[model samples]
Target: MSARTSAPSWRPANSSGRSLWLAIAGLSPPAIGDSHTGLRLMGDVLSLARRRPFTSAVILLIVAVYVVEIAQSRPAFWLEGKGDLPDIAALGVVWTPAIGDGEWWRLITASSLHAGLLHIALNCYALVVIGGAAEARFRWWRTAVIFLVAAVGGNIAAAAIQPGAASLGASGGVMGLAGAVVVGAVWSGEGLARSQWVIGAIIATVAFGFINPGISNAAHIGGLIAGGAVSLPLGLTARLRRTQRPAPAPKTQARGTAPGRATATGMNPRQVEFQRRIDAAMAKARAEREEDARRASSGE
Candidate 1:
């Protein structure tokens, strides 16, 4: 059974602009007449980290990769003039020309590559909150698969639209994580009210597309679809597991009898008596027929 969900104490009563900002930052405004705010806020953040190990690890990887990318992307680098990040160019940037030449691995590899500090930070923040919630709800492996599938889908979408343009980042995958949560909720019959947060997250993702110029909306959309595709099956599987019944054991038949025939073993008294009567009748009929045949031969 699913764990019971309740309204979070930290959730604001209304969706004002300030409230939205707080929600994005994963923080709550100071309550009326509350003094232990710092302690409570720290506790919430720590609790989140503890609950989502996979999310934390993914964030760390993104940060580490970004650090390496900045260090390597200098003026001396060969691809430095071509693009901002040399690490992205060397490691894996979704350059359509390269992909056309069979460097298809960029579809997956570009997910870890970022343009700048701002780019990585934004993506990491989304993953930490949205992806962490998803990981907490489902298993670690499912979350990982969803991220990868979304990443590939996003890159493919970008390449299809902008063949010559280069793109890199985890935004596509992050958007996908949000999309999966929303779709999974609907598939599981969690209802609209229960899925409001996920729905809001999708809206926020799309909102970012309009606000940010460099953001790949196509990749975001593709990742969203990919995430939903991967998570839908999990929902169906969970439903089947919940409703599936144990199969009945096979019945044993009597020796020399056809399948579905009454078995010799475990026969009730009435069935045993009936079988005995039928056998006796058959024997008497055979004896009478044999006697009649012998008499007819002798008389002739």
Candidate 2:
């Protein structure tokens, strides 16, 4: 029937595939509440961007570069890949010989360049999930340092491994975020679930490289190691301090008093008043006892 066919038609052909990739990228909806509401999803995305300003800015820059490239008739799609990249080489892409010739800025700039929209989209999506989480955990400056180090490290490694070819894209930085998350979670004593998602993302990214011949596996590996290396000591120190710290002892109450009851010269006004009343009652009782003793001694 039309209804049966309509349901299948409404689904994107690669819906399942995209979902698997998203899960591997740590983009799955949080477990607490699942919703299909567009407005709520948009609001959450905005909130994440606000929390991670640097990450958001990086994503925006990549998108802007891609748009300009497209408008200028560069390789505009996945199918027409890598043809116009050389045209922008002087502008961003990393070439080893160029670095040797003193174009060191390429190490950082190349990471913001992409071969196509598909590449940029994947990296941005990964950034939103992984980078946002990293920023929230490590703060903006640390996250920025990690990303920059990982990106430059990845490019340098790629250049060394394949000096003749040029490398581009935020893949290295994205992988770095993954690596940082994995090691940071483990070192901070975060539970298995936290580490597993990041590990899964790394595996998924590596798998993508094997499937695509042009993808640079070297950059991914280099960035990952660099990120983990940078975050490990920081995470471990924090965990060590937490473990070594002493626990605070509980406050003890006066003997034979009910919970919430006050004592004399206590911190609270109510307790001070209660203590005064108890002191007066004790004094009167002591005086009466003395009078009784005196009477007995006098045989009155």
Candidate 3:
């Protein structure tokens, strides 16, 4: 009957006592009539869904991606194999840059083009699920970065790895989104550790391989690598791309101040120090969060 005697002395002392006990032990008080932890946890989704702006747009993106792909499937285009570049040329079966140039823009453009209606449909389905979830875990720009980079990476790999091939499909990029979800879940702070997602991705990959005759594994792998890499520092790096700025000068060159040179009218040292601290703190937090996850995974 006593806590000292029982190995598992966790039994509740009836409903009334249990309620009182929880109230006393609660760190954050619960909502009235809502006693379940699952309810509270499900009640908040911003960190998962409702909080992300890019999520809603992603729906449109999904739709648009499929639409364009569907259109490309028609016989009007001159690209071989209905614009399925990888299938046509990855292994040197056929080759040309007819669909989209082997250019950087093609990375994104290919996402909008596909082999057929079914191909587009499958990709959109994957994107909606993966992109929706990715948007939930990562910031909007971060999601955008993974989408862009992964998509580009997939196309690039398709071009490089698949020799003499013209490939078109949202598969590479969308798969990248899936890769982001899987990897981000792996490297997250607290959420997105569902084993189901990983298992599901594996199943989907296998299914895609069996169904789509020319599915380029190269692109899928590349996009995944790109997504994981782009998850860090995507924001500022993106700014440089948009502005087309030349390389960022070293600290000494940016202010036009030589290594040891400064005029009476100089930059604010205090402000600079504060900015440095802010940057350092942010870096530290991100590193700590990642480290905690690493340790937890390693059984440390």
Best by TM-score: 2
Q: Rate the local accuracy (lDDT) of all candidates.
A: 0.66, 0.69, 0.52
Give the alpha carbon lDDT tens digit for every residue of 1-300 in model 3.
101112221110000111111222223445666668567666643443566566556545656655543444434222222333322222221122532443445555655554444454455455545667677666577888788888778767766766444455655655666666666655544455473554466445645454554566667767777876776555345444557967766444224233433333354666555655776788899999999999999999
Lowest lDDT block of 10, candidate 1: 9-18
Off by over 4 Å in 3: 1-103, 189-195, 210-212, 232-300
Name the 10 consecutive residues with the lowest summed lDDT in model 2: 9-18
Candidate 2: Cα lDDT at 284: 100
Question: Mind giving the per-residue lDDT tens digits that candidate 1 earns over 1-300?
Answer: 101112111110100111232365455457857789888878866876688777877887877876776677653322222233333466787777788889999888788876544455556667767787688656677788888888899889877865545667787787678777787777777766765766776777667565654456678788888888887886577668767967877766654333443653667556766776787788899999999999999995
lDDT of 2 by residue, 133-200 (tens): 78877778778888888888888887787676677778788778778888787666666586676777
Q: Model 2, stretches more than 4 Å misplaced?
A: 1-20, 25-38, 71-80, 236-300
Candidate 3 CA-lDDT value: 0.52
State, as a TM-score between 0 and 1, how close model 1 is to the true structure: 0.63
Instruction: Give the candidate order by descending lDDT.
Output: 2, 1, 3
For residue 296, what is the lDDT in candidate 3? 100
Model 2 alpha-carbon miss at residue 192, Å: 3.1
How far in Å is the alpha carbon of 159 misplaced in model 1? 1.0
lDDT of 3 at 190: 42
Clash totals for all models, in order? 0, 0, 5
Q: What is the TM-score of each candidate against the true structure?
A: 0.63, 0.67, 0.49
